[model samples]
Target: MEFGNDCKLIVGVDYGTTSTGVSYALTGSSQCNEVISIQKWPPNCPGLKVPSLVACAGSPGRSLWGFEVRPGMKSFAWTKLLLDPTFNCDSFKVEIREVAGALGILKLPEDRDAEEVVTEFLRHVHQHVCGELKRFLFDTMSPGRVPIEFWMTFPATWSEAVQSKLKRAASEAGFGDKVFTVSEPEAAALAVFRISKDFELNVGDGVLICDCGGGTVDVTSCFITDMNERGVPYFEQLTEETGSNCGGINVDCNLYRLLVTKLGEDFKNLSTTMVGPGSNFMKEFEYIKRDFNGELPYTLTLLGPVPREITLSPGDLRGIFDPVLDRILSLILSQIKRLMQSLERVLSTSKIIFVDGFAGSPYLQIQLKSALRQQMAEVGVLVAPTPERMVACGATVKGLQGIVAQHTNAVDIMA
Candidate 1:
């Protein structure tokens, strides 16, 4: 926390496609990456993430965001992904449009576009975060505006159009001129460096970071050069960023489609219509998908369904997961290969770290490690302990490295 006296606080917001997470820390303190994460919202809900969803009974001002919306509420899912002006709907296996239609949430006035929905959602986030800061950090401050800097994260795979749209939405949502943007993988890497006890970067060391979110997976390989005077680590790009649309949502989509095919249209309509909290198929899949390692074979049983229980064997589950897993593997292998060919000398010490909630799956980490270690035995794979907060915290860390590091250097020079 070698921050400057000029700044009062630094905030990071990971506005993801599936879930949004926020993290903040005071600047100019000696608190080594000590961050406060916005896990629970009003009414005391559990979990460090909030669903990236928004619903309006009428006007955008009346929208309900995140955990505030009930399951039966007419809300939109994956609204952030929808913001991509160039998104190819045909390639996306899951039809978000159809899902919206099925849920009947797209009725007039409430039928808002991606940007509109996101703006409303972030507005709520801004309000909540500001209130929390006021209560905890600024309670004793004099009657004046507190100086705060904001960092928002986005995928490296996104085009400038997508990134600009995000920035615009944030601006509309009340983010001030102090706000800045960072790529998901970059933010995640700094975050890892901060939290990882064994993490150390030397002049020749290499590290690969894979940030797998709901809608996209971004991979970056960094070649560590040297630390700043203040002992802050810095990295140079080793390979071009690799990314894929294959993420946890695709797995969920495939599983859902498979279930629909097996259970028929009747069940499809019924479940999507009245999917109770954590009792539906996708919810059930989430609870177990991370644990399943294709070990001893697997079967996902549809829970809370009336009249009959539906069961899917390991073969079926694998069939659903194979395509998405293949895409992810391809990205990982591509980056590893690129780095190994280029940094053959330090390849032995290189490590791959997966951040973001989707990549937190033990099954995925095991599969990746098994596949990767076979090729490079000395390499290691570690999943971020708190996948949900890694991106947000990483964004915060990015600000620290850039702003605070520079300020500390200037201060030392003056002293």
Candidate 2:
């Protein structure tokens, strides 16, 4: 379970579109066996994440990151979408621009085609990560004693060019030759497999991952190929994998439009136009999003522009979520069915695990459980622990292999 980890560290960064999250573990410490997501950051919060936001406070070199930017300070979000060379600026124009306009940022036209913004945001991430790591090491171990390496996560559906740009961004952020990349879906799968204390997986048992994130829903299935000497599940890919842009963010957008239409432009001007993905109304709406059972209707109260509230019945929530949820469920269920058919065990039970923030929605989890049970009793579904931090946690766990390799190579050279 140990990497040749003396005087070394392993770090993983989940540079998500909505939030950036990180975790660091000493190569030799028991932490190597338990991936710990960094819980502290500037102006400290109790959460394991910070908004993936950046703002131009001055020229190219000066910027504000995360919660550093004050309200109306022209910060940019969804910056990670820039890495997707094929991502349509036009397709996302309204939502992006609304926030940009709200913040008074004017570079949307100029920065749309470049990687500088993404790099700058990641630079902040890297700097903060180093600071946190240094503080921890300074207290328990000597500073400058342990060499650090990074594992960054990206969308499984991202193009190679997009991934290359991400790597370049990491390097520009000062990671140098110490960066590695793992697909978000794979990282999520790894995190779930590594953390599940109960061993329900026997050799040949299949696990399907529905990494339902902010802007994309990726589905990948891997079968248990073998177990490590420690009896950990070893995976082999069983499907081509697929995804779509219909994630939580899309539902957020749909809800946003509905609000604007119902509440009017004045309310829009005063309230968060983005909804729950870091929106002003998130405090009130996020609860509804999580708690609204398909059985009963719900109400959301917003005291903005004027004190006001609105009701969205169970039917209403379904109307907003069904379109997006249907797309995700189809992708996940199809993959499971395909796997079942391929394995020629159509009637036999299989494991399907859901991870990432969207999977935490009780309403969504219920729908998944019911759908799978009804569609086929052979499929068992469970949401992994720390669903919100799946990518970062998984990357942290998987990065140990690289640390061990580097340490061994250094040993070889000395020998």
Residues 13-43 of candidate 1 have per-residue lDDT tens digits of 9998778899987655555346888877854
lDDT of 2 by residue, 1-415 (tens): 3234364667888888777789767767655455678887666766777877777655656888786755445666676775675665535545545544433322442544347788788888877777777666655543334667688898877888888889898888777654788888888888877865553777877778888887778888887878887778888877777777767766666666666667677656762333333445554666677677687877776655466668877777887787777788888777767767776543344787887777778888888788878887767788887788888888887787654434211111111
Candidate 2's C-alpha lDDT? 0.70
Measured with C-alpha atoms, the lDDT of residue 227 in candidate 2 is 82
Q: What is the lDDT of residue 330 in candidate 1?
A: 87
- TM-score (C-alpha, index-matched) for candidate 2: 0.85
Looking at model 1, how many pairs of residues clash? 0
lDDT of each: 0.70, 0.70
